[model samples]
Target: MFAVIKTGGKQYKVAKDDVIVIEKLEGEAGEAVSFDSVLMVGEGAETKAGVPFVEGASVAAEVVEQTRGDKILIFKKKRRKNHRRTNGHRQDLTVVKITDILTDGKKAAAKAKKAAPKKEAADGDAEAAPKEAKAEKPKAAKKAPAKKAAAKKATAKKAPAKKAAAKKKED
Candidate 1:
């Protein structure tokens, strides 16, 4: 099943197992996140859409990681005004894996658990699950802050030629 949901002033059409990056949400990795503002839900030919938001419909996801988007620079210049400014920004983001789409007010946890079998199925042991989650945490923690020390040189301004012109006139 697929559903369209809204978050961070944006809309996303998502399905089970889809990994998506979105505006930062306050939660650690592995935390469950649910989007309640569902615009539409559908399976094949059967579709239901909300006038504003579909009643009793939601999308459930698990936070895969917290991340930052690529750095973007914003530069402004005023021609002939000796004014220029350069700034850089990086947006905070969260990577999430959609686990379930629910309709008719179904609680997400029930279905999400059903989607991924817990323990002993894949790893064949309960201890391995926590170890994997622990191992992944350090990787996310190693993010270096975006480098802001290197500002682009503003070399557009040129030395005035008025003095040179006057010297030539005197000669």
Candidate 2:
């Protein structure tokens, strides 16, 4: 079975036990890397394509080695200007062996791993909030009654002042 995977802004056609050279991946040798973006998969005479990317399709590969790729010599020259420059570069790469092609893919694994810890954290917060609310309720109730008593006293004083002003006007 052969599959085409896209990684690092490039695409590679790969199969099990087939060695391929590609742009650098960040890792040491003998590490495992799984490519989640699978564009196409073919086996024997059958081929399946992805709409943008195949849903639930993945390729798991083992990083067999990591090394520098072929050196590219960049030369710039201008006639009659005595300007010539040359530079060489080598790109880092990781050699990986295709291990497995999962048609149902990596989304399930990633989603499960991503959600488990979040759910646990949310439950922990939920359990702690009720205790804090219980501790705060009595203090809130005491403040509410104090505010009501202050408002009643202010109204009582204003009513007597209005009555005194009315008697003065009549005299």
Candidate 3:
């Protein structure tokens, strides 16, 4: 089944499990959102449309993320007037995934919370190996920066001498 819904001053045809990016909506990730301004609903040849909105029809979605749209650059120029303007804009947006389409004034079901993946209790040694390897990486990374510091000190000494010569030339 599919439905035509109106939101953010626009219209969209959506179905179950469909993901769409729409105008900015209030809510964090994994939050439930509903659209009651359904313009039409259809299954195969049978379809229902409304005068303005379908009565007792709604669309249920889950907020995937709150994000911003792509940047849009606006440039304006008036010939021979020496007036010019350059501006850019990125619209706030939201990504949503459709979960259900309901009619007859039905309310959306509550969303389920995700849980962390379970690790094997029998493999306690597997966890310790990774922690030991991670400890060695930072020690090697720290030694490389000491060489860069010595090179930076040599350049710093030359910079001050060049500035002193420039000062003598001015005098």
Question: Highest lDDT, which number?
Answer: 3
Best model per TM-score: 3
Backbone atom clashes (below 3 Å) for every candidate? 0, 0, 0
Which of 2 and 3 is the better model by TM-score? 3
Per-residue CA lDDT of model 1 for 34-80, tens digit only, reads 89999999999999999999999989899889999999999999999
Q: Candidate order by lDDT, highest to lowest?
A: 3, 1, 2
lDDT of 2 by residue, 90-138 (tens): 9988887777788865432221333457659778799776887898999
User: In lDDT terms, how accurate is model 3?
Assistant: 0.90
> What lDDT score is found at residue 37 in candidate 2?
88
Q: Regarding lDDT, does 1 or 3 come out ahead?
A: 3
Candidate 3, residue 64: Cα displacement in angstroms equals 0.5
Which pairs clash (backbone N, Cα, C closer than 3 Å) in model 2?
Answer: none
Where is model 1 more than 4 Å wrong at Cα?
110-171
Listed in order, each prediction's TM-score against the native is 0.65, 0.59, 0.67
In candidate 3, where is summed lDDT lowest over 10 consecutive residues? 113-122
Indicate the TM-score of model 1: 0.65
